[model samples]
Target: MTATAATEHVASWYAATANPAPERPALTGEIDCDVCVVGAGFTGISSALHLAEQGLSVVVLEAARVGFGASGRNGGQIVNGYSRDMDVIEAKYGARTARALGDMAFEGNRIIRRRIEQYGIACDLRDGNLFAACNARQLKGLRDHKALWERYGNRELELLEGEALRREVNSARYLGGLVDHSGGHLHPLNLVLGEAAAVESLGGRIFEQSPVTEVSHGEPVRLRTPQGVVRAARVVMAGNAYLQGVLPALEDRSMPCGTQIITTEPLGEELARELIPNDKAVEDCNYLLDYYRLTADNRLLYGGGVNYGGDDPADIEAVVRPKMLRTFPRLAGVGVDHAWSGTFLMTLNRLPQFGVINGNVYYAQGYSGHGVTCTHLAGRLIAEVMHGQGERFDAFAGIPHLPFPGGRLLRVPLSALGAWYYATRDRLGI
Candidate 1:
């Protein structure tokens, strides 16, 4: 679906339970700054915060409210690393480059923990994340994943199987699981809102309801909105899949895919703990995966199901509730209190697309389904490159991403068919 009304957040459990914050005014007149960031989600806010911390003047503009896109409506699991794991990076871009990228794989998690402590952001910040396996093949992959990650100095891990795995989730769905001490889950919207407050405290500015209609790329980049124009020496296109038409070049390289989530009515503390006894964020190893976790208030926030073409399922609640039940039959009669869908960019290779456009215009997109922590990393990389510390930034930008091959008309159907094939494979446990 299109962005919700600018004045309010979309219908979501996060919106209902969100902490209070002052509403930011929309851009209404011409303004100039050292840098202008489009989209006030994680990337924009994080970029603004990073730049402002350096004492640079930064302005952020958003189509709707802060974290109104995938940033707000995600499953809230901060799974470490990229959509494509490090092994794929090594195969595609050699060991040396993969090693360099690997160093920063978990850096975003550190950035998040630091922000929570430094700013005292109350996001229900927790520790540890679980990667569950659906079958023996995926179980072996998790075993290998533990080894691969340990090689990168990430040694805080626990492998669980048989009764241990079932005890952790209290479900028979998973064959095994890998728990990463560094990864965790939290109130995603609150995290972004707190970061936005921190950004303002650091002297950065943010504008809501100020969607850019045009971007004139020149020496002093001009971003034109209906009510205002922001001119800056540098511009960042961080809108990801939600960005439409402002820059056709970046839009062509990423496809907007929809994912749905449902939050069950408060299950009392005992039931909640029983569902996830350790209370770690859990995601399975299927290609089309289901992720769920207990909220601070003890609700089961479960999310899965993807629409590759960015179309909303006719009944989002209907589409997702069954999936939740299938995973936890004990919750057969649990009433779903909230349901919502949001979009994220998908790339051909399932890797994030990071690069520059016309030299001064920077863009990052297509995180597939792995954007939570990566968006913060994207902000850091953007800040690094803007200051000429391009090594780490280039490590990602150096990787290439092809445009959606089927073009405007056929990409949706083409990608959907491919997704079906892979999802079939996942279902068959092949």
Candidate 2:
């Protein structure tokens, strides 16, 4: 559960191009607040902002600078829906609960748009997303997915086929795609940092470089950092993959899996338009999905491939460059400007984990790979639960999550073995 490796993995394109913000002072001496939040990522920051708006005293603790984790380093695809499909949820839960969850997913996207407008966070917000089909089987799957979504009255998506998709993407690699107008892309780091500023403006205190080393629950929870401590009426653990062993019970529900991304040098307006004609973010239908989008500066930021264990694969470009070339080989000679990696929390059911650890201590994590929009909704729901409205929160809490098989030491290997099976299925076109 050490975070030394996680800290070293923070050099990203987002970090290199981030705008300057005032340095948040580190935690010093002891303090108390109504709520103490761990991890200053999207979930924690968004929660702090909402809680502060409700006139609650809140404090946020971060191990590094603001937006230093996956919140800053993700592919920035603000996709709608949960990690698992709604139909799968309906099969497990009842149809009523599944439809409610679908509505919640749509609400999550609305919350993101509202926050961006309210805060005036200028993060290069774009308007569309394309879920492409790399093979014939995937093409059929995308069509089925479109019909399923339509069944839930979610009809903002269209299924493209034949030459229509090829005309838009100019990629013979994909047979067709599902275009979701509800989904889009943005500069994630800017969004996170801007939300942090909004939280501070609302009188919430955020401490950077203040990692929580221990926590003890009493009438008021006490969170201890290296230099200081925070005593609050309640505590929220939003650290996600970087949670480490701060909360052992929560840590067992998921494992940290590393994903890599690389951005090529600017491709100019003509080539950018040719790559993604309508300037939409694109991800192919694969167990290990390939996602990419064009930056405001015209760089093609492509991401795919995952490292199941803790190994940070060398030659990231060697692994991802060919995938990018496969889609847009026209950029074969384009030089990659920045190559980086980040860790995402993956749950056993591929669903987000939301539940109260004890009674007063609530935690949310394990959004799988569908966190950009879901995290915002999670924050709002957590805020509602704190404000004595726990209906929606309990709905998500009903979903069960089990600890990874094998003990702490063996979990990684077990996960690697499981991932290999899915990887094989994706390759065999199952």
Candidate 3:
């Protein structure tokens, strides 16, 4: 997408109410740093912060302004765990690796809180999340997942049944749910922007409007942009879905998927409390999941709409408003103040992709819909590996990610075909 097209694509509620930051200069001349990061989303910024804090000279190049991608406009749920369930990981990688992965997933949430406190970021952090089951089968699945979590000795989950679930969420559509105190919500844009500030404070350079156009790997990696280039010993590709053709090897490993969200005009405290008395982020177990949370200002922020094709549908409100009303009919007539969409990178296995290409060029993406927390953990892991401490990073890198069938040109169609199957399964409760 062109720069203008990218700007037009971002009119999210988070952007509209984001905390202002100083404008940084665009890259105008060639520069060099110990580490050069491409794309200024959460992964890039967080990686830059961690590297800079360790006293490495780092420079970040953003295609657009900071917090201009999915990092800024996500559902804001700091969900604990990978996009793939723990059992899936255990089945694939055995119990030991699965437990390690599960512990890392929980650490992802803790890392975000630690950064918020360490940087004094004011992103309206909350401390609750609900995984609501749409049917009895899903409820049973939730119970099984809870049991596994307890077996692992990480039992921070509270099981809510029937009326108990209704008391917390005011939704009769769900049977029972799991409330996780460790998982919560936050102002996503604020968190990204704050991290960017923290990166700069740690003596890192961030250049906005500096889209990397070309990359060459040799003794020293080189990244070329429209106006400038960066040469460094190491390069980190943190572009995620907006990466375009920066790294062709990653193209087939992940596909860009669009997800939409809508926010209503602020509901008063009383009404907001009535909607979600516990102020928890709520999400259903459907293939096309419905996740919603109340903003710090009391607006109902509802998000769900996964499209394999990258196009952003014209009628954002039309597509997601009904989903919102299905859970909160009391807000049926409430005006939708904002509607926007973001592109998330999803892998075939629904797990994050972390590996080094050609040894020195590191890339991390494919968070699926579980990035709000995982990206932070990814940054830390990437930093640790860069500093010669690769234990945890190697564990994640060990998880293999297959290239999307049909390659780049046909992956979307292939994914769409697969999505249909899942959607049908969700509808049939099978």
lDDT of each: 0.88, 0.86, 0.88
Looking at model 1, residue 267 earns an lDDT score of: 100
Candidate 1, 305-374: lDDT as tens digits: 7898788888888888887887789999889999889889898888888888889999887889999898
The alpha-carbon RMSD values of the candidates against the true structure, listed in the order shown, are 1.5, 1.7, 1.5
The superposed Cα distance between candidate 2 and the true structure at residue 422, in angstroms, equals 2.7
Q: Give the Å shift of residue 193 in candidate 1.
A: 0.6
Model 1: what TM-score? 0.97
Residue 301 local lDDT, model 2: 98
Question: After superposition on all CA atoms, how large is the RMSD of candidate 2?
Answer: 1.7
Candidate 2: which pairs clash? none
Task: Kindly state the number of residue pairs that clash in model 1.
Answer: 0
- The 10-residue segment of model 1 with minimum total lDDT is 1-10
How high is each candidate's TM-score?
A: 0.97, 0.96, 0.97
For residue 128, what is the lDDT in candidate 3? 89
